[model samples]
Target chain A: MSDAAAQVGLPPVTPEEDHKVSEGKGRAFLGIPVVGWMLIFFGVPYFLLFLQSLWEPTAFGVAHNWTLENYKLVFLGDTLSGNIYIPTLLRSLKVGAMVTICATLLAFPIAYLLAFKISNSRTRLMLYVLVIVPLWASYLLRAYAWKVILGQNGLLGSVLDQLGLENTFLNNLLYSQTAVVITMTHIFTPFMILTIYAVLERLPPSLIEASKDLGVGRMKTFLTLVVPLSLPGVIAGATFTMGLSSGDFVAPQLVGGKNDVMIANQVYSQFGATNNWPLGSAIAFVLLGFVAILVALSTQAEKREQL
Target chain B: MINAESGLTGAPTAGAPAGHAAAVELDNVTKRYGDVMAVEDLDLRVEDGQFLTLLGPSGCGKTTTLRLIGGFEAPNRGEIRIAGDDMSSRPAYKRPVNTVFQQYALFPHLSVSQNVGYGLRHAGVSRSDTAQRVAAMMELMQIPDVGERRPRELSGGQQQRVALARALVMEPKVLLLDEPLGALDYKLRKEMQFELKRIHREVGVTFIYVTHDQEEAMTMSDRIVVMSNGHIEQDASPAEIFDRPLTAFVADFIGDTNIVHGTVTRIDNGHATVDVGPLGEIGGSTDDDLKSGDRVRVSIRPTDVRVEAGAAGEAVVQDSVLVGGHIAMKIASGDETVVAHVARGSSYEPGANVHLHVDSDRIRVFAAAEGA
Candidate 1:
């Protein structure tokens, strides 16, 4: 063969072809392992759940019917001993919204302090440790501990009584939506602080100094510069708190009375006490739908901000 | 007595409008961080509309001096004045100056226009006027298309221009640029130097630039302050600082020079005769307070040492290396070694025993005590 024909037979000469070959090799190396892992772990479980959602329970076992009855019952609500779950769904959303707001508000100042004010690395580490230490304790134990604290003659009530504030404590202390919101806020506050603090820590100090040099007062700089820059962390914290609080059954069960029992409690009751797997799964699907919609909205908002 | 005429004179153009008055003055300013003094007794006067550079080696307190003037840090002692007002206790936000940091420090989340409009917005300028000003500033920077682009989307040079536009939009009396071109590559940095000079001229604001690179300082500044060890070694126009360095440190720091130690044997008029051992007698002018028989170090710039074959003048060439545009030759007498720059394409070889003629007028004399 001539030289040109020989070269052409060996490989294509274009830069694009060279790029494609390398890219193909790279994709094969990285893509196969990740897709495999996702399929085995996440995709398979989600597929099974999807299939189960469409299945109807029979005397022998469950079988696929692919009916919309379960979804309808979940959304429209069905009479369960003449009581419906709509109120519980609303209560769960209310508790989630309150927890998100409370945690975000409480986290901002602590995160600001950790990121901007605290300079010593050891002290920051210590503060982070303190924030995460509560997670080391059993979640059930923490819920039960709140039960002791919020009870009629618990530590808080005793303190109030000792301080001669028994009337105020008794009137608004426990077993209400406020109590549930407050407990959930406390439980999820660390997540908010940590997420916000992580974002704030990555912010360059020069940006703040530049603002100051540009005649921006301290408060204005914080509002205009620091706050907007940390929106990602705020979103992350809010989504996490909302997801956790909406699906939580433990805290409400331990400290919450009838009015504060969230949708998760109803699902648990349907599955365990009422022995209604289909209804429980339906409620779970509803919760999952709500979370997915919220997460999708947040992701869209994040994408817009990034662009 | 300090000459008031020289101190307060405006630019030379007669019909041209006088720019704003002096914006910043550092009077014997000293800053100490623990045992290390970052700036020691710095006295600098920044003329309005003039670009002054604090040129020095690293750790020579140029940045510290810029920070002190910008109100980012207060001097341990001495007074700083801005617009003839004492700013010793003023915070950065209270100062009538803005700084363009070395890293540009543009808000990564903010668009170019938003970043430039920040100071105006904070100053409570009307929305329409702020928008107009931001647009005009972006146009002036030749980056109108970058108004909506975030900092990360822009190149380093674009980011630098945005930083400048941001600071300039504030209309601060003084603009402090701390190594503003340090992050850019050589070619871009050279381009930005001219751009910065033009911007300074057009905006008519006093600029206090800090850089360790001597060439950048020399190229852009109306006056350069060469500093060493937190002290101002020499403060003069670029030509004067380069040509007439008052100290040995200034001589060595600014450019290549050959220094030789000797003892003064005689003084006549503006010239001093020194006994430089193997080189026999050398003549130079004294910048130091040297008496007869006192040891001194004489400095001659490499460009001032002329090498000629077949005529012994003062020193002999021991070695030579051709470094394009000029031949760098090592000439020595006794234990003292000095380098001379011979013209390129010169017919000179290593150990050729060429005579070195020191330009008497260009030679600088310094007291041996101030060697550094």
Candidate 2:
């Protein structure tokens, strides 16, 4: 075998080559579950939804004849409903924007403190658990927990009444767009925090030290070095927050007023009560497309900018 | 001679011309991180326009001392004076020194020009001046064309050049290099050693280098401060360090040596003869007091161990390998293995009787209970 290999000009098989051959098998084995899951669960359903969006709705179910009316109606507006869909979508986007901005503003300082200020590994671990422990609780429970805290007759009203300041704490703080934005922000800020924290933690301390060593002070270092380097994490977290909050229907259903009905709420009504799967799927695809465009834009911005 | 070739005659940025106070001075600096004393009551005076290296093994406080000098870490007790200014309480940005970090730490987001000009921008240099300085520095580092390229896009050697350019552009009072060539391959590191030396002489900036590699220190530094266990073991020139090491640790750590335990049998004039067991007596000169019966440790370099073919010998040749310009041979003497280097033409087969001659003038003797 050795003589044949030498004649063929094949390099002698070394330990490193032997190890790489075994590693290839392990890699393929490790990749199986994700591939299988994405194919079976995500790919099939997403394909069906896309197909349903193109199909025409009939008396029985979706008809074989394809139509663009469902998509056209979404953009052009429904004449009978008096422009409900577009306004609801704009409102959902507004709510998402407000929530994302609020969450980002709230999360950056916390993540910075978590990554830099806290040095003890045990303490950092404890703080990390504290941030993540709230996530393990049911999302519905957390959304409703905001209601218990912010409701007009719930925690705020009682606290105001106890403090003897009735008129000072008045803002129609429940069953409104404000309430919906607040609830969504509360629900989604943790993802932003964790993302930014991970990015900040992986940043080499030497980078910051180098910045300081080069005659840049603390504030300037934060602006130039810290902020720009962590911009990728900001974009990722913002994308996550925007996509999830804009497409979410739970908060609008739970604590939102009638006027707080968003695109997802319209999507739910189309699918559930009306049984209009084609329109529902179209609306769903539209939201997905908008968020996908946003994600693409943010990713492009991230690629174009480097710190 | 090397500086003339680099084309950088006037380093106007090198603050406080050479005849000022020492470039950097540490007055009894002590730093303790919890239980471990990183540095202890260290008083070091780095003269102006000198390439001084803090040479030691890992965890020897070399890096800690550099950090203290650079204001990255404030010493717990003592003053750090840079250009005769007490900068003990000042932050890193306020100091007159800059550091070329161990890993380069070039800003990845910025172009090479931007990274090199970053300090000048903070120093409030005009935009055009910053550009000119950055360009001049890039040219000096031989990386003029890489200005528009990001640090990640450049090769490791180029990145190192960019780091040097960035740190040197501002012409800091003193430059702290924390093993700047450590990340490079052996060949690149050797090339960089000479390059760094040339640039050092050209720029005329006081350089405080930190490295565990003793040979690199010997090659580049005008003064090498040998450190061990958070304290200075020997602060002297490289030649002095190699020839007359102050302690057992300094002798062993600087280079390969055959350290044998022995006792002082005679002290004649300036020389002390040690009674090494089995291998017999070896004579060496010591700077410290040496009694006739005092226990000592002797260090003998491989080059000092002369070899001769003999029928009756105390050592047997175990192996001989041709290593570049010399033949490195291992000889078994009693229970100990002693290495000896001979001429490239010298040949000795395994199990051959070979006599060893250690030069008394080259042997270094130290107290037995010294730094371990």
Predicted complexes: DockQ each = 0.56, 0.57
Q: What is the per-residue lDDT of model 1 for residues A43-109, given as tens digits with 9 covering 90 to 100?
A: 8976776666666755555666776666677677556643366667877988899889999999999
Query: What is the Cα-based lDDT of residue B215 in candidate 2?
Result: 89
Which residue pairs in candidate 2 collide?
Answer: A306-B109, A307-B109
Give fnat for candidates 1, 2 and onward, in order.
Answer: 0.84, 0.91
lDDT of 1 by residue, B45-143 (tens): 766667888988899999999999888888999888888779977899989999999999999778888899989988999999999999998888888
**Docking verdict class for candidate 1:** medium
Query: TM per model?
Result: 0.86, 0.91
Candidate 1, which segments miss by more than 4 Å at Cα?
Answer: A1-43, A58-66, A79-87, B1-21, B275-280, B309-324, B327-337, B347-353, B370-372
